[model samples]
Target: MARCFSKLTQTSVRIEVGGGRSFDCPMLPVSAIDEFDGIREMLGSVDKPETLREVFRRLREMAARVLPEEYAPGLARFTLDKLIELVAYLIYGDDDDQPAGGQAPADAEDDLYEAKKK
Candidate 1:
């Protein structure tokens, strides 16, 4: 008896980091909405994940907090790229990081996540 939510990619997201490693990430309960908000607030300007590792760490922590009874510390490890995809799926419900046009960089206009320093 489960109700689907638009914010979630699916009932669960499969995180694969290769080398025979994988983690099944379950969608957080509605009560965890505040946790999602906290994550968003901590990560300003979602152009890219400059603090990608930090975001992953928090997500792992959140999963543990919500499902403490099933938390397995040993299965919490995640790679940078996989973590980035996971973050996108959890936040946006789809791991499509490519621009709508889906074109490669030919000039500055193609620098989707590139930010210049002042």
Candidate 2:
């Protein structure tokens, strides 16, 4: 049986970094595809010095979209690694993608999604 793509649902994500700061992100899987691809492409094209700057701009803009207004202002404080994780979570959820060390690169805690229905 074929299903309607428009009927897909989203999961709520909570990103809690150090200092008791956390942002509740409601992310849709369908919407994260473009964001993930863009960042991955930019990350792969790291020849020129300007690529980093361009990616940082893109990363900031993307984070700003999901963050609360108060947290938006603190976007600059977030490391690029954290921003990438947030976007990756939006796309992949928590699927054991973590490195062998079982941790991410930042002080950020893991916010996993409950398993989706089969």
Candidate 3:
């Protein structure tokens, strides 16, 4: 089936966040590419955004609490791009966030959305 093939094609990417740290992120499901793009665009608009140090710290802490310790380090080292994708997964990957038709929230706009709507 197409679904099975899609899953098989997906890969986990390792992001190097410098200082020899890295994180492994499961690639976005093919069906969710648009959502992933939206999240990426949204993340690009912040001014003087938080340092990678802070983001990595939080991500590591979150991973440690939610995932096994071995997986935490990888999640923490995610590059900015990978971090965005991972964040999208965290926010919209679950059943609670999924609607009857698997639609994500429409309000999930990127930075461009905010600028245009304003």
Task: Please report the candidate that would top lDDT against the real structure.
Answer: 2
What is the per-residue lDDT of model 2 for residues 8-89, given as tens digits with 9 covering 90 to 100?
3325455665786655565545666887687778889888879987887787777677667777777677687987876667
* Candidate 1 wrong stretches, greater than 4 Å: 1-9, 42-59, 65-118
lDDT of 3 by residue, 1-118 (tens): 1121222322434434478665544534454556545544554664545644554454444334434456666764677666655555543453223233333333332333568778
Which candidate number maximizes TM-score? 2
Clashes of each: 0, 0, 2
Q: What is the lDDT of residue 29 in candidate 3?
A: 46
RMSD of each: 15.7, 9.5, 15.8
- Comparing 1 and 3 by TM-score, which wins? 1
Tens digit of lDDT per residue, candidate 1, span 26-115? Answer: 555565667667766666645566675566677766655423354347336666455444544643444322222333222322242245
What TM-score fits each model? Answer: 0.36, 0.60, 0.33
**Candidate 2: regions farther than 4 A off:** 1-8, 17-23, 95-118
**Which runs in model 3 stand beyond 4 Å of their true positions?**
1-50, 94-118
Error of 3 at 88 (Å): 2.4
Worst 10 residues of 2 by lDDT: 105-114
Ranking by lDDT: 2, 1, 3
